[model samples]
Target chain A: MNVGIVIVSHSPLVAEGTAQMVRQMVGEEVRLAWCGGDPDGGLGTSVQAIIDAMESVWSDAGVAVLVDLGGAESNSEMAMEVIGEPRSARIRICNAPIVEGAVMAATEAAGGSSLATVVATAEELSPL
Target chain B: MSKTMTRLTSEDMKALIGAMQAAIAENAERLTALDQAIGDGDHGINMKRGFDAIAADADAICDKPTPQALSAAGMKLVMSVGGASGPLFGTLFMTLGKSLPEDFECGAFADAFAKAVDAVAARGKSSAGQKTMLDVLYPVSDALAAGKSVGEVAAVAAEAAEATVPMEAKRGRASFLGERSIGHMDPGSCSCSLLVNTIAAWISAKEHAA
Candidate 1:
């Protein structure tokens, strides 16, 4: 299976919109899931939602999480904590900007890049 | 008065949560104002939202043993608050919960608090003097480690929080503002101080009542 991508944002619209852009850039070769909003459907990221999204798009090839803002990063870390073990070992949180990072990482994943390479490709965008 | 309790009873936990909720509510606007100066102006609102979730679930949270109650409260904050502090503070409580025994002594609580502070620092890749929550958290944890009384710890935390006002931002969104971040209190530090002080006050009140 190709590598997977999970988009995390405080705003549901931002996550969905960024996922749409990644889909357009990478096509159907990569698996993708987007999670955003609080448990109450308000602005904020949810650890449960991030965990669920990661599971939905899990891949043996590896999964990369792109998060919006600091809160999303914090919640994503909590999700990873509970995820544990071999699965947690396979996932990585990218430090690049959410939208651009998702697109770049998805492209690399679609090409069957390893998790580290995909993350590196995305992080390379930081200087831009 | 000697505060000798090793473990906070469920009732004690409830009181602490109550005090925290009230403090956050009282300082919400001030937190927002602080954030507006150097970061996103939503620290107060975000903290209030997280604490409100804790309050809404207080009945269930307080029914559990201390560790479980703390963990539950942390989870609620993680799910409700959507800012950097959400994860930072969530991890703080969750780690503290995980580190504690079902019944713990003050020294045990100190160790747990230190672990929780470490977890938050690692999560944020932050350190003391970054003008983030760590500015407050670091001192409080240190005081706890030193075996200082809760009142003394709270006093140290408040001083550290206030000291953040003149420090340069080295992490988080505020760091983007560079030197401009100075002169503004870090919102996370303010909230952290408020929580620590509330806990101190609650414990003192309980001691007085006895």
Candidate 2:
């Protein structure tokens, strides 16, 4: 089974735009979703939305998340607490840039790669 | 003059929470002004939003055991705050909630607080002298561990918050400013001190009343 991918950003438009790029680059085969914005659609990431996105694209092969900023990463980590064990063990947040990482992970997932492999492939794009 | 806390009642805990909430509200604008100089300028608004959410359910939260109430508030912040601080401060309270014993004691509180501060450092991946809340937290931890009075520790916290003004930012959005972040007080540190002072003031008030 192919790994799933999700993109997270602090802005609604940024999340959607990144997801768009990932979809266009990796084709429709890779399961994918994106979420962002605060509760009232302000410029902030929501842990609830992140959890929903990850579950929306969840696969037995696992899901890899790409986050745009600090809030996205921390809130994504908080999402794991809500998601609990078993299913959460397979979810990983790549430390790479949101857009590049989502595209790269999706590409790897498109090749039917394992979650570990997909996450690793995307993480390789992280800046020093 | 120093109080050795043996039994912390739910009533006292609720009052502490109330005082801390009010203190945050009072200094909201100050926090915003500080963050405006070095960060995205939403620290005050975000902190108030989380505290306001907590206040909305204060009655029920204060009715629970201290640990449960703290954990509930921490979870509220984690889910609702929507920023790096949400998780950071949430970890602080949640860890304290999880670590504390059923019957509260000063020594136990000191240990739990130390562990909570360590969790915050891990969550932020930043340590003391980083011009973050850890700056104030570390001093408060030290004072608590040393069995300092709440009033004394509160003073330490205030001084620690002020001490951050001379340090350059090494974490968070402020870090990007490098040298420019040196002269300003850290917003997180100030908020941490606010909570400490509020708790101190509340305890003193209760002691005087008794």
Candidate 3:
């Protein structure tokens, strides 16, 4: 499997919109999933929803999670805890702008970059 | 004074949840207003959603041991609340739940709370004076370590929360505001102080009842 990308945002629209941009950038074959909004459909990220997204796009080549805000990062961590093991080790939470990071990371993953390369590629965007 | 109730009971946990729910409900608007100054302006709404989940599950949570109850509450928050505070606060309670002993004493409770606070710091990659929830939680953890009463700890936490009003946010969305963040209270710190205050009030009421 190729590297996967997960976008976590507090707004469902933001997550979906970012994923749309990433899809346009990376094209098909780069598995991508997005989680946003609370269980009640309000603005907030959900741990279970994030975990579900990660699982949906699970890749043996590893996964990179880009979070939009504070709660998203923390919730993603909680999801990682639930995911556990070698798979958890394979996943990384990149500290990058969600929209740009998703685009860059998805492109890198599409190029079959290593998980670390994907994460580094996203983090490098921090200075931009 | 009678000996302090060391170990928290299920009843105490229920009371704490009740108090927290009430506090969050009361402060939601103020929290949102604070966030409007430097953040996305949803801290209060997100917190209310999280606490509402906890309140909904209060009966189930109160059926567990104190540690498990707290952990469960944290899980609910993590699942229900969004934004930075959700995970940070969720980890705080979850870590406290996981670290405390089954029959914990006050000192052990303090230790567990400190550990939870540390987890929050690590999770946020932040520390005191960062204009985040840590601004309130760190000092409150210290007061707890110093063996302060719950009321005194609440006072210290409130002061720390107030101290954030003058700070330029260094982390999270508020950091995006740069120097503009100064003069606005951090929404997370405000919420944290409310939680601490509610816990203090619950403990006081419990003591009075006993």
Ten consecutive residues with minimal summed lDDT in candidate 3 chain B? B1-10
DockQ of all candidate complexes: 0.69, 0.81, 0.75
Candidate 2 backbone collisions, by pair: none
- Model 1 spans with C-alpha error above 4 angstroms: A39-43, B1-3
Predicted model with the maximum TM-score: 2
> TM-score of predicted model 1?
0.93
Given candidate 1, what's the lDDT at residue A110? 90
Q: Please, what is the whole-model Cα lDDT of each candidate in the order they appear?
A: 0.87, 0.88, 0.88
Clashes of 3: 3
* Fnat for every candidate: 0.79, 0.72, 0.86
Q: TM-score, chain B only, every model?
A: 0.96, 0.95, 0.96
Question: Comparing to the true complex, what docking class would candidate 1 get?
Answer: medium
Tens digits of per-residue lDDT, candidate 2, A1-128, equal 68888888989999999988887887988899999887657788888899999888887899999998788898898897789898889999998988888888999999998888998899898766
